[model samples]
Target chain A: MDREALFQQIKKKNSYLCIGLDTDLEKIPQHLRSTADPIFEFNKQIIDATHEYCVAYKPNIAFYEALGPKGWESLQKTMDYIPKGLFTIADAKRGDIGNTSALYARTFFEYFNFDSVTVAPYMGEDSVKPFLYKDKWVILLAHTSNPGSSDFQLIESVVTGRKLYEEVLLKSQRWATPDQLMYVVGATQAEKMESIRAQAPEHFFLVPGIGAQGGDLKMVSQYGMNAQCGLLVNSARAIIYASNGQDFAQRARQEAVNVRDEMARHLQDYYK
Target chain B: MDREALFQQIKKKNSYLCIGLDTDLEKIPQHLRSTADPIFEFNKQIIDATHEYCVAYKPNIAFYEALGPKGWESLQKTMDYIPKGLFTIADAKRGDIGNTSALYARTFFEYFNFDSVTVAPYMGEDSVKPFLYKDKWVILLAHTSNPGSSDFQLIESVVTGRKLYEEVLLKSQRWATPDQLMYVVGATQAEKMESIRAQAPEHFFLVPGIGAQGGDLKMVSQYGMNAQCGLLVNSARAIIYASNGQDFAQRARQEAVNVRDEMARHLQDYYK
Candidate 1:
């Protein structure tokens, strides 16, 4: 989907929430384990329960990959099951050399048909450029939510005096427009969101670290929202694992509703 | 595999030549494309022909991933076909948050049973730590082979006056010992190999960009060799695509032999 279509979805739903499908076989309800494809089954119910409340679904590829070839099947099934109009982000942080990266672009965009794929900026321009297809998106990693984000992303550059992530934010913009490019700025770092938003005002930011990761929805919305509701605040564990019982999907819907309702209020108050 | 075991294999073969199985269905001989599981068939023949000459086989994961679930099957079969006592590197330059990185670690080290997986150091220590299993390895990206490697990698840090790649080399050393850690010092950057070797004295460097990318094996061997002959120089296209006809396997073996002979001479001249 293009930038306007995504913004329309957020506006129509009155929500900018993106539910993350970081589904683990071991973490799903015990009864579902008896099913043939437990991961897909779990994701199907969760999507059915929460699809109305959210605008996008971001599947963390590692969860499916750990299961081997069978995992890829589950992932493909999950992708097929997600309803079309809503956005899809393969939260697969993939980047490599030029030719190898093109294969990855084909993997996520052509084979699996994701709207976007998260890419690491460490490999620089050519590694990231292949994924910048017309309507498809490349959500480059800027300020990550993980503790380790500080390790390298914060290092000051002697020439530009910009921190590593800032350099990533600046240099990457030259390669693609906001229409096909976004940034993965973790909600955990809400304090930096204002400046980051100021720097790249037009681009969307896929914000993770809400709910289970201790990121405040109010704070993130206050500092991060844009004219088009330029934020995809993701909550994975808090929504999907709301309850491990038979009412798991129902409980997930309740959690998503709560987050979405809050997002609606933030949309009213913050979104220009 | 541990450092001593890898060194033993290198000494036994008198070579540290790593064959990259970047097998593409479109690029393989037309005859092989007609067969069932052609990727695996081609890889099987290549392994059969060249296993004795090379000490390590590095499979670029994107080639398999682009083909979807079937591609994964071909990779598994190819892994099963490679002979015992040779090191395997999953050139799947992957890294993410701690929990996610753990899943990727399981995918490669446990599920795929690779000796090591190339990791991008963009995510910091925790993202890399989970892959440091006993007898397993993490070949971290220090300076890459591509032209874009100059973009962020060579950015000088204000505090330490060290480059970004230099910071990666220094800071990452604190996370793991030389036993399980290695660096990817690209062959295209042979001029920097001597300084890199000095900074990372004991750790092995997985050198790519040898043949098709125009890196000099002799220069790389001269500057990058260590006490344990710390280098696994990789040549993919130059060796694997030596012929496109039915003689592909035979010709591939000849190319492997030529590279291995050159590596043996380097070992004889440079071994401490």
Candidate 2:
């Protein structure tokens, strides 16, 4: 899925929301628990209910990995269950050497069939380069919203006189085109949105910390958005475990609809 | 395990070697191909033969993850095959937000049962803090040997007038003690080894880029060594795929012994 296709989907649905499949075993509904693959069963219902209303699904790999071997089985099943048109992300923050990283690209892009994967850039270009395959996005970590982001990433570099995150943005962009590269700029860092935009004006951003992290969607849309509606705002806990009851899928859909409606308003403003 | 325990083991075996279980399915012996799980079987045999000669086994997670669900199954089996006392690493360079990172910690330390996992410190303290559990090690990416590592990591920081990698080292030490944190200083970057040691005088380093990447084990030991002989020099391709014949296990043992002998010479110099 390319950026233009993603934008069209956002326009068609009038939503820029990406459902986070941070699926935990113990938190899943009881009805699905009896099934051989509870995580997949739950994901199927949620995807079926909410696919039309959203453009993407970001599955946090750690959740599936925590269940040991069984969690991985569920993750594979869940990946298969996601519709073809909707963008899929194996939210596995993987980064390593060039040769090893090439294998990671094969893992998510070829084996599990994901459109993208999150990566840490601390290992520099070689670690992130292998994943920048044709049409597949590599969402590099930049100016995150977490509190300790200020510790090292926000520090100013004496050489370039730019923040560390800015240097990552500048250096990594040379490795891949905007079509293959995206950045993860947190929604809670709304104040720094304009500066982030100034750094990499063309790339899309996979923005988390929207709902459960209490980042205001209005503030995010106001400052962080681009001409292409270059944002895939993710909400994990807010949509997945909205209700732990048997009506979990139904509540998830309702929560998703609320986000989509707000996003529609943001899209309308984009035209203005 | 703590520094004392690891040092004691290294002394007992007379080896500073850490065999990298970068087990690729296509690279394993053809005889193991017919086994129920070729990857796991290959790892088991290699571990069985080389366990006595090496201090630790580092399984790069990308290889297993590429096989999809079955690959993960092989990873768990391989982890189980490693003896209780032998240190195991997930080689998963995972780093995220505080809440998400907490779950990643549980995935490796609790579920997969690895003693340590690699992490990228580009996102700063919050990204790394979650992985520092009671008795686990969080190996942060420091001076990587990749060509583009100087892109951002080597930048001089305005605040400290220190290189970005040095900043990562100085700031990250505040989050965890030397026991809980380690650095990934590439073996190829031997020229900078003494400077890295001066900045991070006490922390252990997980050194890669040896053998296959042409990093000199001799130079790395000379400058990168600390009071505890604090270096885990990894050789993946040169050791594991020493041969593809039925005598693969014997060849692997010999290759491991070679690296161990070189490391022993380094440690001997430190003792003198």
Candidate 3:
């Protein structure tokens, strides 16, 4: 999906919410387990109930991969089921050397049909440059929401007195415009959002760390949202696993409604 | 495998060669294309011919993933077929937030039974620490073999006047011991290998770019190689895709033998 289309969805829905389909076998409703594929069944119901409240859905690939070949089949089913126009993200943090990266690009963009895939930037421009095919987005990791993110991303670069993420934001502009590229700015670091936006104002920020990670939605929106409403605030367990019983899908819809209502207010209050 | 087991494999084989199984359906010999699973068939033949010459097999995950679900099945078959004691690496550069990363660790290490999986360090310590479970190894990306390695890795850090890769090597040492952790030092940057070894003396280095990428065996061995012959020199295209004709597996065996012979000499010359 293009930037204009994505922003249009955000406005039309009045929410920049991206529900994370981080479904696990042990975490799903027990009644669904006897079905042909429980993971797909769970996701199908959750997407059906909550798709209207969110602008996108991100299926964390690791969750599917843990199930082996059958898991990938379930993932394909879920991807196929999600309604079009709701942007899809393969939340797989994949990046490799140039030649190998092309196969990954094909796996997600061509085979899986995701609109974007999160990528690690430690290997630099060549590793990430392959994902910049026409229209498909490359969401580069800047300052992630994890504690380990400080391990390398927070280090200040001597070449330029900027932190590694600042350099990533500043240097990666040469690769693509805001239309083709985005950045993963963990919502936990909302204070840093102002500074992060200062570095790359136009680029969309796929912000995780909101619900389970203790990040305040208001603060993140206050600091990060742009004129285009450049934020994809993701909530996984807080939305999808809101309940584990037969009412799991109903409870999930309720949670998504509450979160999207808050998000919609933020879009109206902050986005110009 | 543990550190002693890996070192023993190198000593027993007299080769630190890691054969990269970047199997492609279109690239395999025409005769094998008619098989039910040509990729696995090609890998079975290659492993049969060259397992004696190499200590490890690194299957570039992107190759199989490009084919969708069946590709993963072929990968599971190839993984199951490799003879015991030969180290297996899921050449899937995968890492994510803490919980998500745990799933990736389970996917490659527990589910697929790979000895180790390469991880990108952009996300930091927590992203890497989970992969250190049991005896499974975390081959951290230190200095890659691509031109883009210079983009972020070679950038000098202002915090302590160190390069980005240096901080990665130094900080990551605190996360796991040498038994569980390894580093990826690209063969293309042989000059930097000496400094890299200084930061990480005991840890094994997974060196790629040896044959096809024009990295010299002699130069990489000179700067790398600890007392344990601490290097797994990988040659992908130069060994696996040595020929595209009917004698493909035979030619691949010859290529592996040639690379492993040179690697064996390096081990002999450096080790006490």
Per-prediction TM-score, chain A only? Answer: 0.97, 0.96, 0.97
Per-residue CA lDDT of candidate 1, range B1-272, in tens? 88999999999999899999999998999999889999999999999999999999999999999998899999999999999999999999897868898999999999889999999988898779989899999999999878788879989999999999999999999999999999998876566888999899999999987663233888898899998989999989888899989999999999988888888888999863
TM per prediction: 0.98, 0.96, 0.97
| CAPRI quality of model 3 | high
- Residue pairs clashing in model 3 are A148-B124, A157-B158, A158-B156, A158-B157, A158-B158
lDDT for each residue of candidate 2 in B47-109, tens digit (9 for 90 to 100): 988998889999998888788778878988888889877777778888776767888899889
lDDT measured at residue B34 in model 3 versus the true structure, 0 to 100: 95
DockQ score of each predicted structure, in the order shown = 0.85, 0.74, 0.85
Interface RMSD computed for candidate 2 is what?
1.4
TM-score of chain B in each prediction: 0.97, 0.96, 0.97
Q: What TM-score does model 3 achieve against the real structure? A: 0.97
Model 2 misplacement above 4 A: A189-191, A212-215, B188-191, B212-215
Error of 3 at B249 (Å): 0.9
How well is each residue in A17-125 modelled by candidate 1, as lDDT tens digits?
8999999988999999999999999999999999999999999999988988899999999999999898999998897968899999999999999999999988899
Better of 1 and 3 by TM-score: 1
Model 2 Cα lDDT, one tens digit per residue, A105-169: 89888888899999888778887888978889899988788788777787787766888889889
**Top model number, lDDT:** 1
What pairs collide in candidate 2? A158-B158
